[model samples]
Target chain A: MKKQYWTEYESKVADDHYYYERSCIRQSFFTGSEEVFINIVRDLLGKDIADDMNLHTCSGIGYYSGVVPLDTTMTVVARLFALMTEAGYKNFVPSCITSFGLVNEVVDMWHHFPEKLEQIRGYLKEANGKEFDVPENIAHPCDIIYKYRKELKEKMKYSLTNVHTGKPLKVVEHIGCHYAKIFPRQVKGGAEFPQVLVGMIQEWGGEVVDYPERRHCCGFGFSQYMVLANRGYSAANSKKKLESMQPFKPDFILANCPGCTMFMDRWQYTIAETEGITYGENGMGIPVLTYEELAAILLGYNPWDVGLQTHQVQVEPLLDKMGIKYDPKDKYVGKSGAFLGEPEKPTHLKVKAYE
Target chain B: MAELLDMISADIRYIDGLKACMNCGVCTAICPAAEFYNYDPRDVCNTLMSKDEVAIAELLKTDKIWHCGQCLSCKTRCPRGNVPGLLISLLREVSIRMGYFTESEEGRRQYAIKKTLGEHIVDSGYCVHVMHVKPHLHPEQGPVWEWYFKNSEEVADRQGGNYNKEGSGALRKISEESLKDLRKIFEVTGGKDFFEQIDRQSKKKASELKKNITDNVDDNEYFYHVYREKNETQE
Candidate 1:
């Protein structure tokens, strides 16, 4: 009966023909994870994923933070759909889960209130002289990865297993709240236990730790972090998740949302600095990777090129455990082999530096 | 006060989120904010269910509206389908428009958001541009970020980001034509007016607090106060 009930919430993902919507914050936070994802799709899988430079943000951050009004958010969303319409694509894929939820929420609102849709249509026409057809399909990047996890596993150079112990690496997968909690039917699995990241982790030869606070948010509440005064709430919430997962002894953390990935990574250092506690083994912090980064590592992309170094919690410890070989010297080098200078190390989180 | 209630009643979030509440604590029990902060989604619903204008006005004027993380987790658990998170969104907007956002520490911090995320949307077509994640403002971003900040162009190019360049890819420069349309959308939809309201109310509040306010939005003394000032009350 439980299995039967969960199956009712499964979402349908499009096979191909994706109009890729780049996330504004993902680029700022995760740096090159989007590029890695595009490469995995276009280069590895031979999928046709299109991107338009004219495309802008969905204004989700501002909208959720309470500065941008709903009317403006709706108009901005309409313009994105217009870009998709102009590009001759029906499938929409947003890199950020927040954008995914924002678009879905706006479209759902439009469906329930056609008057709001009509008002937005007028605003779009008057403002930009453009119109948009609602997209036929909307999928997050993780949904795409989950759909083709088998094909990716076939092309893998490494697995999530720890090469030293020969055991499946234990991982804690944090799904962004907006990814499915708001609308369960839109995700691969239901809201309670999303299979979007779990499907990928299992396919890549990893063990998923079922933590008590698994459903709790990573607390990248837009205004919570944007305003320094409220950041304690963000940190405290993340700490709760980390503390809950601590007893599970997970090897690393992975998240689909860029904001969650960032907070989970950085807040480890913040926790270490302020509270003098670390979640991972030894004195090192737990490595936090995006779904794209995890895929890139297994697919044999250069660690630096995939932007693993951008994370505050060092990925080196995890890389070493996985026995993925790379010249530590190349970590800070430019694309042309020119060496970029190393950054100062922190007092708490352990980061490997080579002269 | 009645006008404020009318404003909230007209919002789509309010219309969709608040159906009917039976004073159940299901939402509060599951809420992450409730665990950390002195927030209860049940109390918020109970207040709205009463429909008392004075109480609603007081709710809007306090930090209670801003206590929500906007995770919408409350929506998933509500037996009556009352989404307290969405109601909070409505309450927050009404708070800002009514100039009641300046009444508390949390509400006043919307000024920081206005200068950063709010302004970034109009100026860069991004809520968070790559160039704006300065290491100084975001110390949590850590040491590697400092290196990334200095060698931004080289690193961005290597990572396949367009990094303010024309054409397609990650962090590509959004075209001027597209930005003009985006700006016009903000204008047509009253987002520009909303930004002005945040600015106007925030400036008035700054004067009330006697902080050194200036025309420079980013570097002003009042901006610094709201952006960095630690309110220990949260802990």
Candidate 2:
């Protein structure tokens, strides 16, 4: 028997409802991106989306990091599916690229080995006393957005072209490893050259820049970075990517995975702070944005309102290029629009406005 | 020795990751861990194929398996279709199961990951929650994150997350019934067993090393010892 993989896009946008599964890292690092996703789906796309509190983390990090075993990881995924079934959701949208990959991988695994599926079913029965119907439609928000790029582009208040220069912004797209690498055919483009992110960037009027290390991992390496001692391995890889992309002079980076986004964003700061070396022009790092964040920006959401203020690398340079209007005073303000008092700006940030 | 080799051969990850090694250095050339650490995936595959039980056992007891970032970059480039990343996963599993994980400095730190992420999942329903990722614990989250941690609830609220409140939004309180079901799933799926085994093995290691062992995951001296131990060579 030949090894079979998904060759076509297998997911569709939920016409009416979607059970939005949260990614642990995304909610933790880019809190506003999830909200922006919800806004785009619910308020903009006119879909009734529910980010259920019942949905647990996919434990992708734990499992991939080798702390959690595969069987346990599958069961946890099975339990989440059961929760989705209980919630009466037939369409699934994952917030994290890693979670998206895990869910797809588990579903495909169960498909290939019915015995394992039955084993997980038996476990689910023992645990919840319920049977789960696998979601009919499952997609990462990126996929959903990719599918509706035309509609999104139509709804956009801003394009990816620089407002000042009137030229398309040079954007680099970093696809998470789990997004397509695990199951290449499942993604829009095969793993070798994925276009899921490129589709979004192009549709939003940005020039997608391909660099030498375009396929490099963001170095989250879960355990490699999580354990402080092993962080050098993670940092080294990120440094490699920074060095690879430095020549491109990308105005910004758009990542589909929260881990990738966080790492690509955070590790630049880490590399510069620890190693005293920086990438990109003028020793200022390229700003990294989650796909949802870029979407929020294109849809005219305030930069500060979308939590760009929380980024270690100042997003002001990109915002200025895009001519996005945001108040510096409002950046540190509370939910009720009250100023929370400013944090002493770190010296690493080269942007005078942010400093 | 035959039994140990059988265990390796039987593991699906091992089966999936290895086809036939031609001693190709592609896996190492592309390996991020190899670039920094004294680790090589080609050597790992070569040793596993050697089927020497002592060498395999020694490999498990060393920090070598831990060095794999599990990026699966090896899977992408392997001309023989071998996945050294997956091979690492299987080795790590067997090491933990056999208590060989406690034999190395890096391997002993598995307990810290087990306690932090393992307990975080079972208790909080999420592997990482905003509340649990304290600024003090994760200084890499930086000063803004420190502020966010202090004003997390408000920040969550502003971002349209439900935080700890009840409703259909991010970080909302997972229902007790659902949490119960989650716990049951863990129980039935052997997740609890896996965690307990890690704890038991680590405790035994701690006893041998003359470190204090406590039932409480947080208060356990061994847990804190590994968790806070910084690499002298980190810089």
Candidate 3:
């Protein structure tokens, strides 16, 4: 019996030994996303990778937010859910940086917060009737894919191959704060400005342009922006990011997570309006694209087909610059609650945890 | 003055100060707190200014207020110097009063960062600014601390300023002392003792965790090793 419908990403995880963790918050926000990444990784890396996967909610993220507490053992047990994905496997990947850091944080601090860790261990023991060994190795999705960048580049069937135009295409990198700050060490390919995404982009033939405030948070801290005028602050951060990259003349600003993509892309126009910052057609007012979107484009997929035009700012110039033909109808309709079909699942999807 | 003070005294001292911000968003761009967390400093300013109690109240329910790293990076850079970071401090104060984020685990963790580093500054007449080599160069952050706690004068000299000169650099001590007072407002306001206990636990727990991490840290420590080795090789 063939599986009814899993994202192409599942194929890669199944074949590639994809790493991941399950996040409670993400599971709550969009349950389909983790499932999408999971199924995709399983399909790609072969079932063995999923067998070794453990996606779970990070232990302490919500506690600091004062939302979830130390006693909120559900988040920790959620790790067991991911472990069950691979039957209590070795290190799995976490897509969400926060989940990655917080899970590791709980494990690392368990020796110190013995009671907190033990409480979590106890819950997992009773509830799942299973034990977890916080594996010695773990990594964020970016850190993992970054390790195989050369292989990804070699296996490329797409023509983002021309994005650099035989000359290095200018691009700026935004490393999520949780990725850098949570567990600065688990990040292999080295830490301290690990350049996981940027290195991958460079390997794919794009220049990883360094902008000031490169490692600044994407302003998603607990979705404060959604709750208030964090829009202004997010917009402001976007300006700082865009302004910093102005000198470098990057063709596009690339974001990693969905939150950063939303703020950087949506808030740029608003930030520009409020701050009185000017933008030329192909200038400082650039659009933000995620690596998934970037990868889709790098593979020479149709811009609208992959939702490029869904961007708030006009992404035409970059396409025009790249000489990539774009579908006119691909433009995102007004944000008046119009369904643009489901957001395209990124091909070569990386499995993750809130892990 | 009555109206302004009325706004200020209305349980949240930042109400008046926050109103001064036009929501220009300049503060958010420069805030180091926003750099690490998903918070927008300007949003706190905007929320305080909105006078829309429900929105403000709903927002206060989150722990984002505690995410403020309080580097004063936003304060220095605000076009009006409005200090959204400080405004968030006021929010935390109000949240404490309202019992929103009182004694949060993160706050407890922060309390430790402050008690260990902060208490020492209050007692020692110095801040971490003077002690420790540039954080990037110091791996353990202890040796440089041990040395610079005594020899900070050389760093002061290098910066072309004598902090001990009562008329010039010493003036900073006044603000530092006052800062201790301002923070006391945060400490003693509502759940001060609760904050203290969490701070204690966090400091104890954090140090223990750091020891374990450091003990297990592989041959490659942090960027400190890379920088030092690279500098030596370059030289």
lDDT of 3 by residue, A1-355 (tens): 8852211211112224444544433322222233433433444333334522122234333333332233332334334443544364555566555555545544554654556556655655554445556554555555545555565565454533334456766777776655544334345322235566767777877777776667665555442331222234445555666666777777677655544665565455455444545343422356677665565555455555444543445566677666677755434322232333322322111111121
Residue range with the least summed lDDT across 10 consecutive positions in model 1 chain A: A346-355
Query: What residue pairs are clashing in model 2?
Result: none
How far does residue B64 in candidate 3 sit from its true spot (Å)? 11
**Candidate 3 TM-score versus the reference:** 0.52
Model 3 chain A worst lDDT window (10 residues): A346-355
For model 2, how does the per-residue alpha-carbon lDDT over A1-355 read when each residue is reduced to its tens digit?
A: 7743434534345566888898888887788999898888888788788777667778888888777888878888887788788888888788888788778878876776778889888888877787888889888888877877888899988899888889999998898987877767667666777778888898888998989899888888878776555666677777888889888889998999888887777678777776767665566778999888899988899887788877777788788888888888777877777777655544574545423
Ranking 1 against 3 by TM-score, winner: 1
lDDT of 2 at A271: 72
For candidate 3, the lDDT comes to 0.46
Model 1 CA lDDT for position B133: 82
Q: How many backbone clashes does every candidate have?
A: 0, 0, 46
Where in model 1 is the C-alpha error above 4 Å? A1-4, A353-355, B231-235
Better of 1 and 3 by lDDT: 1
